[model samples]
Target: MVADAPMTPVDIEPLPRLARLAWDRAPALCASRDGCADYHRSWSMLRLVRAGGKPPAGWRFFHAEIARAAARGARRVLISGGADAGLLAIVASGFRNAGVVPRITFVDRCATPVMQNRLLGAELGLDLRAETADLREFRADGMDLVIAHSFLVFFETAERARVVANWAESLAPGGALLMSSALADEGPGALWRPASADDIPARKARLQAQARGAGLTPAEAAELADVAGRVWATRPSDRTGGLTEAELRGHFRAAGLAVERIACKPRADAPALGAARQRRRAEIVARAPG
Candidate 1:
């Protein structure tokens, strides 16, 4: 039994436009040799949208923090390395939920997500700037809040430090950096692999169910499941080994950011997704010195 309740149409209404954009564009992108096509194909807009544009855990805390930042006069926000509009929507909802509006800058290396975000921004009447840029080389100063979701794992171990340093430099004095990372034991290799062979089938089934629940036809859901399974089995995931809590804190400290909070917990949906190992999810909040 899928533990989550059935979603009402209103719950998913905001997603179809973006989903249409992704679905229409993914095939051409795949044919054009875009490296992220596998990801886009596997986690279709249906899947992403059905996931409710929120992290599996600690989302309340994140939402609260965003509201608090806005209350404290945070107006300039940066969303780093999101591959789609999901995180942008989540952040925008956070501000609106608190009756605040902040100017947002969203950066990703992929043009597709940039375009999607631009569409979302227009729909929301938000002051959003969408750009395609590598986060490692991207530079902007005086941002009041910098946010990313499950982002660090996408970078190799060596690149993680540089990314954090860049985020630090992008912040205004006393600005905050809020992010989440999956934590695991450090290993020599950086490649991300399925936790176990069972992980593939379990994840595929979940995706198929989510796709169906999001209103895809049975055949469409099955196709998505097939693509997701094949991609998971054959493709090298664009992710590196997870970071340890100590390593995460060290990086923030080395970047001269004071660690305000590091809340670690097992992901609520991890077991359902067939994560065999006990991977801890960490929500990090850090601040630059005044």
Candidate 2:
């Protein structure tokens, strides 16, 4: 979830007509629907409402992020899950401006991205393509960038690892994998969970794993247990290990990508709880073999 939006996804009435029209023309979504509190949060949810969230008054921040990526020579970046074409277009535009003209390979379970990419590609004459292939089998070794913001967090523990491992394979050895998530293992410790939350099981699993990795037995794992906030915590996560700092490092160790850094601010209202207050996860950059 985004910092601005409420922790939970409570449905709010959509914005007015003029508001939506004005929003559609801009870049990113200010909220999930339009005017509640789900401010620009995950690269995923934000992508769903990109055309329906941003007011004409803003879009620079959205443009800037894409521009920076294009400037770095991301000529042909891949948006793993095609559902975020709006988000991909945001970056594609930047790549176009840089004269690189990106080709977004929208990979998803359905043809939504295929349809969207076809339209956008036709309009911009971009080399966009949509694929229904499984991530493990999809090819992507020469791409400049690969992204899967929140989609991977939906996988089970073992599946998540396999997905990341496959992502590692798809990458051209040194290409980058920029994933966004709500989980993190960097914190003083967690205190209480919101009445509507269910991260304890995942927390226990990871803490247990950590203790085991730290030379603890099952009994010891139970003894040295605590919440380290959420890792790649976008809900429906079994454990944040394959995505959190610890997980990122662990995956990188096996994948060859050295994580650069993570970004987020812990919860402010109840920060005194000493919980890890952060939103954005980390961006892991790897070097592809030439």
Candidate 3:
């Protein structure tokens, strides 16, 4: 039998009650009226109640890297994307566990998640710097650690290089960028294949069931399901797709960061939204050369 990896000291705290409240209020707070609010609302609900509320795969590796940076007297952490405060909380907890308190900056285009992170920060008694800006255009310097989980998939193939370059520029020498991406067999320029019309009912039903299980009222669950269907039906044709392993690595190296470590593994328990295709999850640690 393969031996399990030794456990690291980083512990992922449970999603705070305020974070849940932020998610619960997301629909109203979301500025995107074109089904974007519904998109976030449904996904946030499912994520909150997903089996065991488990952190994403390879979280231990992320924790270890964050702890190491903290031990090295690193500060000025940045989170490149935000759908919720979950990533912020994880990074903060990692630094605290490592016996260092780092200043954290969170950037996201959407105001709702920025507010959410602010609320979460207050709840955790941590001062969080939250910004509303697109990652491709946002810039900072002297960052010791930057993290973005499942963030790259949202950008088109042509836009990814710029985003990676921005990430590299934001880091100080010897600073690290820790990120994860969903991988696919398809190459660049491949857009996510939208769900077929026939599949919408089944997908909505599943989401509704999951929402109810997550404590949404029956009516609220139905609304969430309806909104999800609308969003999927109208999903943009240019919605960027997953990156192939090669594309992911190339983007990092092209941005002038040294690829320190990368691990990709199949996610057996991924939700059914894209279950028809084989998708792997990648956890990467890249560093800016001193």
Candidate 4:
């Protein structure tokens, strides 16, 4: 059941006003909600490659662990940054099929995925709700589990820590948070960086080469270039990037959550440039102390 009182004080700070504004304008700026599906499919393909053409070990563990939580009586599950609804759908379906009823909530601002999630919930007959809410201001106590995958990278470093604290505080004591992401060993760079004067030609050349190598027709390549350019146009300057496993654990611990488990491997599918961005990625499960 949802708790009557909030576990923590309301988060007074908001992400940079620009960050919120950009996100609010994303639908219009990008003019492509279907890209969300493509994004979900790309991640699935990445997992296959990382597993040597099989499902990644981490994903297997992810499913098994959620089922275990459900079996242990976890009923209120929240998936933060569930904008795509792809992972949320899988989680809800798994619990429903396993006969473990859960009250699943999707916290995302985008309307497209929110609509997608509702349709999915109706089809699966799972108890699910999509809330177009800002996670920074989100509050609920007695949450059994929270999932945040590929989420923290959207904010600046300090913002990431604060958000983590909010999530940890929202959980009932001993409740768990599941997170997975590729991490950089050094500075947490922008998730999407703008091209500088020197960067313009270099980025253009790279995109052209990539498109040609992928066998995209001329029109498709031009379209991809247009999309790529627009992405940079909307990028937040202080966007968060990656963190080492130890570094991520430190964030949880600092927030009063204990590091429960960590699984890591080099990015098996990363290209040369991608490898420079991050050497490896990790899947982590951390819990609030009971």
Residue 131 CA displacement from its true place in model 1, Å: 0.7
For model 1, the superposed segments whose C-alpha errors exceed 4 Å read: 1-13, 29-34, 44-57, 185-214, 234-239, 268-277
Leading candidate by lDDT: 1
| Candidate 4: regions farther than 4 A off | 1-58, 186-225, 232-238, 269-277
Against the reference, the lDDT scores of all candidates come to 0.73, 0.48, 0.72, 0.60
Q: Write the per-residue lDDT of candidate 4 for residues 40-127, one digit (tens) a residue.
A: 3222222222222232234555566777888788888888875444566457645654567788888775554565556666766778
RMSD of each: 6.0, 15.3, 5.4, 10.7
Clashes of 3: 0
Candidate 4 residue pairs that clash: none
Q: After superposition, how far is residue 195 of candidate 2 from its true place, in Å?
A: 5.5
Total clashing pairs for each candidate? 0, 18, 0, 0
Q: Residues 1-290, candidate 2, lDDT per residue (tens digit)?
A: 11232211112212232223222322342233322122112222222222233322112333444456667766667777644245455555455445556666767543434444455556556677776566655667677677665666656656666767777777664566665555544555443345334656765566567556644467645633431223223434444332456665666667666665455444434335334433343333444444
Deviation (Å) of 174 in candidate 4: 1.6
User: Candidate 4 at 100: error in angstroms?
Assistant: 1.0
TM-scores for every candidate against the unseen true structure: 0.81, 0.57, 0.81, 0.65
